[model samples]
Every structure is written in C-alpha cells, then in structure tokens.
Target: MSDSDPVKGKYAAFFRGCPVEAELLLSDIDSERIFDSIADALTETGYIVLPAALPLGISDALFTRIASFEDDVFRPAGVGRAAEFQLNPFVRNDEIRWLSSGDEVEAQYLAWMEKLRVGLNRRLFMGLFDYECHFARYMPGAFYKKHVDAFKGRTNRVLSTVFYLNPNWAVDDGGHLVMYEDSVEPIAKISPLMGTLVVFLSDRFPHEVTTASRLRYSIAGWFRVNTNLGPHIDPPQ
Candidate 1:
C-alpha cells in the first residue's frame, strides 16, 4: 500500500491516541500489502496490527510445522500466580533443545525475522536487529498475567512481535492480547486473528495473554540489538 492510503492516515491517528481502537485502520489496508504499511505505522507508535497479514493456506502450513515439535518444547514459569504455559526457544535450560533444530520451520522463521528487521530499520531508523521465535500454546482457562517483555537487567530487546495462528476465533474465544499503554487505566485489547501480526515496544508497555476458550497458538518473540556483551543489559524504565 502507498503512503497516501487512507489506512495510513488512520493508523497515524490511532497511534497518536486520536482513535482508541485499531479496527479503524484495517478498513483501507489490503491484507496482501500489509507488511510495508504496518511497518510504517509501527515506526510512530511502537505498535501495529495487520488484520490479515497471511493467507489461510500459508498460515496453516506454518502452524502445522510448529506443532510437530510440541513435545520437545520447554514451557516458561514464574510470571503468574497460576500455571500459564509458554514455550521459549532462547531458554537457558538444557531441557529445551535445538533453538531452531535446523528444520523447515526454523528456516521460515529466520526469513520472516529478516523481513521484519528490514521493515523496522526502514521505518524506525533502527538497524542491526536480531530475534528468536517462541511458540505459545494456551489451553482453555490458561492465562498469562500482565508483565513486561524486558526486565530489570535486560534492555537489549527493542521490540516484541506476536503472530496469532488460531483460526475462527471470536470475541467469546477469550484469548485477546491486552496491552497497557501510557496510562494506568483503559487497556487495549487486540483480537487473535489468524495471520494477524502485533508489534510493540518491548520495554515501555506491560502486556498479557488472556485465557482461551479453546487452544490458542501463537509465535511470540522479540527483536534485539547485537552486542559483544551478554544478556544482562540494564532495563529501560
């Protein structure tokens, strides 16, 4: 889509807080050309949602490949009072093997990451970005409490991105992504649409994954800066 697209104008306002919901921007954007426009929107607001970023067929293929390794994945803990499932490819434990496993999914993830990095750099004037993919499966009643992606000793994470893989999700599905913006009240809720991509600032906002009525599949990850130092960078307040 061109910069002059009405969706672009709507997104500019949405990001600036003139519009409270993102559905306003989706009206004029073509799902097929979402990559570029969404990138532009993200540059100003630190977040963007492309209503239909992928086709059903491609989304299904990618989800199938991700599900094939369910048993080998390691789930996260300590974020909530109750058990909330999370799979991380960058975990420090031995239980989680082969970060990418050199599989077709890994290759696809790498390519997608490259494209995201290019878009981010072009729009936000940021460069040298890196990322890792993690699959999250939330079953009925499972939920992730509010938390920030970057913590007290880590700030290398520049942005966080999540691609929803579930199909036919509805408002009653209960798997919306809740984000707390600059205010203490009025949280933002994003629908978990198949092929929909959500990007946002990794350190500035606190977010959570709500309970699911059924199974919820998503590729949740972060983009970081490559540095000679380790993973203990100071967190941004």
Candidate 2:
C-alpha cells in the first residue's frame, strides 16, 4: 500500500487527471487522524461529512468500475429485505448492483471499509460485525424519499455510509442529500460530490436524496452488528 508497491501500478493510472487524485494509500495518508475525526464526530454529532476522504487510487478504480457496467447489470433498488422486499418507485427510484469480492475493484473498496469497521470498533466500541454495500446509480431525475436507514430494535444496521463518485459536481446540480432532525428542518444538505463520504448513525437520522439533474453514482452501505434469529446471524436475504 505504498507508492512503490506492486499493487499501486494496477490502479494508479486511473487517478491521473481526477481533481482529487493524489495516488495516496491508506498508509501514505493520515489514516489514524481520519479515524479519530470520524470517531469524535459520531460521538458528538450523529453524522459526519468528509470531503475527499477515500484514497484517490481506490476512488478512481471504483469510478471506472461503476462507469463500465451495462444497464442490465443494475436492477431497480427496493425497500426492505428478504421476504419483505419490494420495488416501491415512489420511495426510491434508483438502480443498484450489490458489491462482491469477485471483482478486484469492489473488493478493494470493501477492504478499505474493513479498516474503517475495525478502527471504529476500537475507538467507539460500536460492535460493528460486518459491512454490505451496493453500487447505486441514479439516472437523471431519480430520487429516494425521506427514510431512516434502520429502526433501533427492528434492524441490525447501526451505521450508514455513502461515498460519492461524481466529479466536478455543480452547486445547482440538484442531487443533494438532505438530512433532517426531529423538528423537520434540515440539519445538512450534502452535495454528492466526488470522494465525499458521509457516515451517520442509521436510526438517528432521516434523510432523502433530491432528484438529480444528471447521472449520479455512489456506494451506499451499512455497518451491521450481529443479531440472532434462530440459525441466521445476518441479513436473511
């Protein structure tokens, strides 16, 4: 995970012209400081928004991987999971492809998140067991209405993460993630800009994705704690 490391050559080319491109590895960057900031933010505020948080090497690879996918590879995103799953266009109108280790780029992203999971557990003792995420694509005009990622006791998801991949996003591009508090006024209106990572307590925030004026891409995921349901220990799906 260094500049001279063999693995760096494979993904480094992708970052050449990107605005946030720094070809930084987790080791090259101040990962410890980043982790500390995330922990402190979660303890004081329910959410944290970070700009250019991901190392450029992996971020570029992720952008390329998602951009290469064909339309057929993505399915309509749905509500709920397992037996309760259903496509509710009124609630969410995006497309998705679940992330898996089968692909190198996706695996790299997952590995990066693993570092986060472990770091947070050590700092906040959040008991995060694992993570699952998907590549979400919102074409022009797509939107997801206000909703919480999880309910306190009804789900295992404890933290939610959104990492954006849209470069040079304009202020009026319209794809802002509006986060609300108890009184209905928004606490933040986050732009889905490149390399911006948002982390929040899943059950404590209500958020919605405003309609996008152009195509949008992001990796949205959750850190889940182990929950038992007879023989099953995770998502029943």
Candidate 3:
C-alpha cells in the first residue's frame, strides 16, 4: 500500500513551526505503513510524529536497557555552555564501553534499532547508507543548548529522530524539547512522551533540551547519507 492509502491530516498549529509537521493519523500503523507515511511527511513538513509507534512493553524494555549503562557512558563536561556549559555523554565510535558491553539488554535494544532502520527504508523510501543511532541521558538540571544538527559541508544529516522514553513525565519535571519557531522570539515546547517519536529537519530547526528536575532518557539520532564530513563547521561564519 502507498502512503496516501493510510491516514493523512494537518497536525495542530503548534507542530507546524517554520519547517513542517506531516502526521500520520492511523490508529495502528505497522512498521511498513509507518515508513511510508514518514517519508511522505518528511518531504512536506520536514518532520513527523508517530504516537504509540512501538508497544509499551518494548518501549519500557529499551529504556530499561539504557539505564543499565549509566556508568559506562563517557560523560563529558562542557555541553550547555555558550562555548561549553553542560555535561554530555557522546558515543562516537560505537565500539567502546556501552556499545561493546554486550549485555543482553543492550543487544536487544540494538537489534530493535536495526529493525527500525529496515522498516524506515522499506516503508518510507529512505536509503539506509549512513543512518546511525545514539542514546542520550539528561540528569537533573542538565540541558542541551540550542543548535542545529547539520553543519556546513556535512549536509548528509537529513533528518533527526528522537524517541522519548521518560514515562509519567510531568510539566514540573522540566526537560522539555524546545524548538524555536521560524527563528523567532517565541519558542514551541514538546513534552517528552513515552513511545512518541519526533522527527524533524536536521538543518533547519534550532532546538535544545530544557533542564530537567529528574533524570531524562531518550534515544536520539540522525538519518544521514554517505558523505565526507567536517567538524564544527559553522554555517557561514
């Protein structure tokens, strides 16, 4: 079946930032169906949200596995600073520590992510050449400053997908995902909902993670194409 065969509609105005919000309104979208809808949505809105995309049990399992690696993650200071402010745990090679830990739970999580990649391409018309997954953990008071995922000479980062895993999260707990609307003054906030997938244009949106009162965990990464890339390359400066 094609993307048009499934549900289609404009999401709330809040989601329609300067870029786009292409949403699939299906009650139960299987992996293949989701892939198609996502691809179509990306073409128009530069992003899409898949609510309840995965089973709750599976989602819980994935988050549990991530929590197991709290110590193994290479936590680095200097994340949120104007030049360097907060702490960050970035796994660059995917061959050390947590990635190489080989715990059953971690293995299961990787397998599920691989399955997601296959589904995305088969269902959404995306090429699976340089796609990768990265896990993120934000402790209480931790925040990621606003920044674009794509850099000049490294435009292969076509899209960014974030799967929020914080269950029973409250507004007072903070750590909301904030995206500036059209590079304007007022910003839009998206609550971190369990099992909800947020996809958006990697190059266009300047976004950041607000400080959290409690621990916040999520699987955040980008979809990319193969290209020789450069480091910290500013857009025009």
lDDT of 3 by residue, 31-101 (tens): 55666777777777767778776656657877777776746564443332244344444411111122321
List the global CA lDDT of all models: 0.62, 0.85, 0.60
What lDDT tens digits, residue by residue, belong to model 1 across residues 1-237? 345643344334333443322333333244325657767666667688776665454468667865666654745433311244345323211122223524544444444455556556766677535676667776576677677887534556777888887778999999788898778763579988888888777777788777778877787777777544667643222
- Candidate 1: deviation at residue 21, Å? 35
Candidate 3 positional error at 149, Å: 0.6
Candidate 1 ranges beyond 4 A from true positions: 1-35, 69-74, 77-101, 151-153, 227-237
Question: What's the CA error at residue 120 for candidate 2, in Å?
Answer: 0.5
Give candidate 2 misplaced runs (Cα > 4 Å): 1-29, 229-232
Give model 2's TM-score versus the native structure.
Answer: 0.87
Ranking of predictions according to TM-score = 2, 1, 3
Residue 219, model 1: Cα distance from true site in angstroms: 0.5
Residue-by-residue lDDT tens digits, candidate 2, 1-237: 456643344445533442342334434447768888999999999889999777787788899999999999999999998888999999999999999865767766775677688789999999887789999999999999999999879889999999999988998888899999787899999999999999999999999999999999999999999888577677633
Report the Cα lDDT for residue 49, model 2. Answer: 98
TM-score of each: 0.68, 0.87, 0.67
